[model samples]
Target: MALISDNDPIYELLDKWHEDDEYEKILEKVDEIPMEERSNKLWFRKISALNNLKRYDEAREEIAKLSPRCTETADIGRLFYMMGYIYDQKNCEFKAIECYRRRAEIDPSWDECDEWVNDSLGYAKKDMDRAYNAFSRFFPDYAEKNQNAAEKKTVEEPDILPYISAMGSSFMSSNLGVKLPLDQPFFKCSEEDKPKVVSFLTDRMHITDLKSLQQDFGRNRLAPLTSNILHIIETGEEPPLDKLNAQQLTHYEASKLLLGKMKEFIPEGGLAAWDYSDMLAIARFMYSVDMLTNTEIMQTYLFANDECKRLFKSWEEFTHSLTIGAFYNAFTRDTSYNINQSAKFAINVGLFCMQTYPGIEWLGEIKE
Candidate 1:
């Protein structure tokens, strides 16, 4: 299907309609396009509008009509997902499970399908054993692949554990009179002790209230600066300095300076590794405060580990990236501060983590 570019006026209008909760307008606009001329994107938007408006019967009808026309796996998977969503909303657990499972079968990489299937099974009070047996029988290769991946992860857990300590140690060691037990692994703290550790770090970080912290962390304030720097790096074309005000120009210059230093140590991944590390730290903190679950924390850790290992060859490179990232973030917030002092402090934190932690070798391999 020849999809409409997002910049197309009609597409933007449709997006505006979606954002404004004008579902009826979306249906009307979609219908204005000849049925044969409509793209899969338009059809998906129409179906989404119907689903959002709680017109489940109409949504299912649209799905049924669209199903046979879907030649691409992505479109077919989406159709099944929409159908599953409609069934779930109507409390038809069995139908929802069937749709979700079909979606998963067609696109094994669609993790949400598996999540919906599990949710539907729970709602139906179906035995997980039976579900697993059925799944294994149909997708033996996929099942075995996942099993092998899980085994590989289990084997690598210990190697990754030390990195977690290194990641969190800068925050832990900053607090005076707060120390982790010397003999015990940092992550092996008792449930009762976990809150204490979190509390100490939160206090040190001056996070007195959850509401404020959540508001601050909800969006990356550095995104604009980061984007500008990345654009300059990729294209070798500078943005119009005259267009930026004094404050923005200052920030742009700082971003370039920090990015230059970052390139010295980080061979790849650039700001992405820093973003993942930030997420990892926040996820751990959130888990401690009951804002996130242990499962979510582990998922965040695994994802961060994968990306960081792919980007960096050794712990020193990762540390340098983190240090520059920290300095960039802080300097952007308060450019009045001495830049050299701030950079030194951030670098010292990374150095402290490497030196103070027992198993954190500076040149340790970031295992693949």
Candidate 2:
């Protein structure tokens, strides 16, 4: 085989730690290796990934591959312990306790094995009680099966899906701008006469009557992110730049109004998403909403690259009219987790304005 690249020394260090008793470090090293061909040390790497990623079955398959000629004095009891840890951490108490027993059986003389088996059994017993008490899917195996499904989807295509979309973490949190009830309740406000609520500032921080505190949190409007985007595409109402203060926007970057997208009216067709992206060129003038940089870059040169343009078009089609999803797709860092940004708010505001404005069609209802 060709001599391992200059990166071999790094991999060699990782290989040394791969089977070390430090389970967390072993996982770190496993992650350090690229996912493409982890099979070289695939056995241990898979073990570390599965245990941490909560794929117990796959981890077991990898552990099986790590076995030697036979279970001798060299007894891989430590590996068994890790398996137990994985199961127990996921609250599969019975399986965890069973694995612990198997580990102790393999190495009757090993002190670590004894301690591990005891500690794991303790956790298993407690979790078993709690599992009976609350009786919920807390032990969902913490299975990242949904994320794995998304990963599988992206691997099958050159057009990788944005991480936020795959993770289903829409970007609705970031745009609301200011805090409400941030002091006493950490952004929660209570009305003594009103009922309990799950989320405060349900859509945007608004002053509605406390009587409106129904189970729905009265979030009758589009998500802030969505409304904001619609606002941008339609009305061009930007965050008040005067609010940014003096130093933030200076002589070099003068305080100016937030620019909106310019759309051409096609008479019969109404308005089409302008293929020309002047929004990006006038980035300085346009409100730099969260993830605006990414969207700007994406929109700027996307059409120039044949593959990228096609992928974008496909994404646009997939997210057509679902402006919320599309804007979130680009604003998010990774789809696997929810983003706290509100870039979609501008889009929502834009679209809302467009629908309500003169000569614009209303496909959906606007509140009375």
Q: Which candidate tops lDDT?
A: 1
In order, the Cα lDDT scores of the candidates are 0.58, 0.35
Candidate 2 at residue 40, lDDT?
A: 39
lDDT of 1 at 231: 67
lDDT of 1 by residue, 171-198 (tens): 5445433333323222344566667656
Q: Record all residue pairs in model 1 with backbone atoms less than 3 Å apart, i.e. clashing.
A: none
* Among all candidates shown, the one with the greatest TM-score: 1
Q: Candidate 2: worst 10 consecutive residues by lDDT?
A: 251-260
- Over the stretch 74-188, how does candidate 2's per-residue lDDT look in tens digits? 3466676666677666544334545555665667676674576467546544533332222122112112232233322221121222211211112232332222211111122
Residue 134 of model 2 has an lDDT of 26
Runs in model 2 deviating more than 4 A are 1-12, 15-42, 68-70, 131-368
